[model samples]
Target: MTASTVLYEPSKDGITTITINRPAVRNAVNHATSLKLAEAFQKFENDASQKVCIFTGAGTNFCAGYDLHEVAGNSTGEVAVGPVDKVNGAFGPMGPSRMQLSKPIIAAISGHAVAGGLELSLLADMRVVDTTAVFGVFCRRFGVPLIDGGTVRLPKVVGQGRALDMILTGRPVDAQEALAFGLANRVVPKGQAVEAARALARDLLGFPQKCMQADLVSAHYSAYDSPSLEDALRFEFARGALVVAEESVQGAKKFDKGAGRGGKFEKGKL
Candidate 1:
């Protein structure tokens, strides 16, 4: 805990792994740690060489949520929240929770991801959770609100009823239940979440970058920004069309060369 509470490690293959290192407190996020986490994610966003990000917590847990100790000792009269500028992006008290990252992020969940931690995981495009992973709105029990994207994202990830069940009841959802609820994209063996997320990131890296990013952006826009079905389709088509000439043409040529024939994938070929 003496060292940085957040750690950032970048691999040569365009994978940046951001870790919450406060395992002593179940990797809880405090004001300082939240700022550090936001900075790390902003660094990843600014680095064009970093294609994907894997977010996890060190030791046994993903994150227990925001440090209640810090919240209880807030005598400075200043709001314990990160800066917010919705036009560009914003950071929540949990840090990076409000960021609209261009690159894909995979949440590697192992232990408890409750309250704010659950909100943090919702920021990721995908979650690779281990058997021990748990998701909940534990903050409900403490009368804490989900100021992060939890309230918005949770309903989108799972249905409104399911999200409400967890939100109102403050019950823990195990990995299996989370997967069934669409909260977890993949469930792996205990202790293998990070590796699985890294492997998934490698698979994503093998694809045409522009096309993948365009698709990702389009999907996000449709999910959260589009006004209607027509607007969503228009945005998707516009963005996807931009990448067609840039990546799809080459991908088509690769396909013609049988690189991905019969559903057989050749890494990095297309």
Candidate 2:
């Protein structure tokens, strides 16, 4: 009910759900909301029981952007406040995306994810945007800058040239364009985004967490250059070696004993 609270839930399939509940203002990140989001993410990060997370808005609109009403009132640029020295920068302490979650997260976007909202969506490992979803670097129109991870992540997700086009032109892109540009992993029917994300999360749980984490870490950190590539591989091996040490050994025994996935897992019944 208050501006500071965001919604948090652990779903039936060990899919933690973090919902932006301030739909009246399209889930704008206020100071309180930011704190709550950080807290919720903390829980997700620590819970080994949860294999995935789903972030979504409570209503039709995913997020309209920053609560300009709240932003307008801040005079803290001259003074230090909450975690950061300035106020106009991205919603630092208040964003679910600024912090990285090791477990996979799927974003379910229903409507518009503009400016900060779009930045938030970009945080997820995979995103299921509604076919009618609208994405934009909307803050440019109002002279607001993207101080969040958007400036950094957008170019990585989409190309730098495309990112520049959005930032410079402030164009609203439909879900199709977002899909084409690799901004979203999947586009679903409107109002079905959350459902699709949830289903994917459920499916993801079938995989071994250790392997998933090892692969994710390697893929994210690896580079084409020899040194960085070698370091990434070393990290991956260090992490993966533990799984291979015992867990995978036991898993192999199980399959050999007929309890393993390979033997019982028929064509596609799972």
Candidate 3:
């Protein structure tokens, strides 16, 4: 694959879909592809008009993992992944895995999302999978360690027992099982993962932008950054307070005018 190994598509309706385009290798990410993936995500974050991002891969599989062929070629003890430091600037082997995006991202998983691919899916706020999708720590059998956010995020996502099971066994968890484990937010038909993810993104795009982003940031802070419950609450309050005047007042006025009543919902209503 060329530089197009990563495809970045931004729609006018505030949805950016980033695709891993190396289908020939089941979208296995190599060094160049990893850099492109990181760049695409940064672009999406920088574009204020893009409210939601749908991350998927080309053809069938979502991703196999970091391209082991590339790793095989590395005779030196050099890191195939980009620079890593103790700060927030760290980059994972799967690229954007380290990013704590302010906006929402949905992963559209169709086929094998194992090893680093599983880690990549964890980067999304939600995963929309199809019947063919599979999740696992496949790299465990190859003696490859997960240097991405996999170890940190998997436990938070699926609990300690389940995370340990996947980490220890490297077994394939099908779409249905993943849904039962709360790993997959939605399961669609065999080929509709991306479409389902797009619909989900549309729903998110309809919300009050500032208020939604503030809540998103606060949730991440509470989940990963806050040292204690008190700190989390204080951070949440502080972040939310900044959005009240900007979005909350107008949203309340709209609500008073009979919007979002009777449990009704429509795209772009807000």
Instruction: Using lDDT, give the best candidate's number.
Output: 3
- lDDT per residue for candidate 1 within 1-270, as digits (tens), equals 278899999989999999999999999898889889999999999999999999999999999998889887876514455344422547788888887888999999999999999999998999999999999999888888898889899998898999999999999999999999999999999999999999999999988898889989988998888999999999999999998988888888888987787888655444
For candidate 3, write residues 9-121 as lDDT tens digits: 99999999999999999999998788789889999999999999999999999999999998888866254555445235567778888989999999999999999999999
User: lDDT value for candidate 1?
Assistant: 0.90
Clash counts per candidate, in order, are 0, 3, 0
TM-score of 2: 0.85
lDDT of each: 0.90, 0.76, 0.91
* Residue 191 Cα positional deviation in candidate 1, in Å, after optimal superposition: 0.8
Segments in model 3 whose C-alpha atoms lie over 4 Å from true places: 1-3, 77-79, 85-89, 268-270
Tell me the deviation in Å of residue 192 in model 2.
0.4
In angstroms, the error of model 1 at 121 is: 0.3
Q: Which of 2 and 3 is ahead in lDDT?
A: 3
